[model samples]
Target: MKIKLKSGIDGLLFGMREKDVKELYGNPSRSYKDDEDNTIYLYNDKKLRLTFYADEGFRLGYIIASHPDTELSGTKIIGQEWPALEAQLQQNGLKAFEHETFDSVDNYFNEDNWTIFQVEFGTVVRVEVGAIINAKDEFDWKFK
Candidate 1:
């Protein structure tokens, strides 16, 4: 899948319904409400997770890509070390403006559209992209 900042992965844009997903990728491997009561669709074969919240019109709000082949600007995300990831970000004209490290895990977040990368043991474990929730805690559907 290709990551599109402030937009979506590939053709699955924000504010799309579940049926749109089903039409594009068939049925999910698993679907359920998460701990926070947000709906979740796990596509195991694609190593992706989709999250939707009722308050957001139940539209697709987040995407978690864990597949090593997941590409962003022609660079693979998962399994990339921080240095490599940083380089990829720079090369793509994207930036990780904030970062934190805890318990040997590194987290990097892009301020633009909230693409987060979680790295463990020196390699990226997963990358998460989501719609922009503004400072007032309102969904910035303008990005759609």
Candidate 2:
């Protein structure tokens, strides 16, 4: 399925209610509470991770995708090489800003939106979409 990375993914926008997620995904493969006390819903078979903030009434905070089939702007981002993905994103008029990573991984985040691509050995393995607070502090910031 084509997932939009505009403000969220697959109609699951940030700030959405947790019950909405359960209704859409029909129960996650696994669920757990994180260190921050947020409940994380994991659909490993679907390659999706959804996090809801406890303080915000369990509203959706982040949507993560690691599936090879997930597409962004008509391009399959997960298995794409760094150069190819970079070119595709640029062609789509999306500006990518490189994020610091301790390991041998290359991370690029879109300046215009909450889209992040995690590349290892030149191939993208993960993509994250969420709000800036969740993206920066909760997700990508740990890499820096």
Candidate 3:
């Protein structure tokens, strides 16, 4: 499945309604209310998680795709080596900035509204795509 930046994943658009998501992806494996009182749907089999903002008519606010089969610009983001993924992002005109925490390293692609988390020294375990709201100076961290 090809992932679209700041827009959607596969055929799922960011502004789509909650019912639309369930219709396309089937019922979520589980659902939970977020801190903001919005609903979050998880499709564990597909390794996909979607967050909806109730205030915005339950529109899709975030998409987190962790399946290795999920591709962006023909590049498989999950399970990709860090260096190769970084190179791919650069070649695609997306700037990658590194953020290191106590446990893992995260690479943020600001323009693409995506963040890649490193599982190890070289492997990527997760990819978060959404409308990043807390972009502080050169670092883009929060996904809204």
lDDT of 3 by residue, 1-144 (tens): 787776678888777777888889889999999999999999999999898887766778778888879888888888888778878877897775756654556555454465545446568877777754445632222222
Q: Top model by TM-score, which number?
A: 1
Candidate 2 — number of clashing residue pairs?
A: 0
Ranked by TM-score, top first: 1, 2, 3
Q: RMSD, each candidate, Å?
A: 2.3, 5.7, 5.0
- Spell out the clash pairs found in candidate 1: none
Steric overlap count per candidate: 0, 0, 0
- Report the C-alpha lDDT of model 1 over 19-121, residue by residue, as the tens digit: 8889999999999998878889999999989988776778898999998788888888888887877887887777645889999888888878688989999
Candidate 2, position 141, lDDT: 23
Give TM per candidate: 0.87, 0.84, 0.81
Ranking by lDDT: 1, 2, 3
Alpha-carbon shift of residue 64 in model 1 (angstroms): 0.3
Q: Which ten residues in a row have the lowest lDDT in candidate 3?
A: 135-144
Worst 10 residues of 2 by lDDT: 135-144
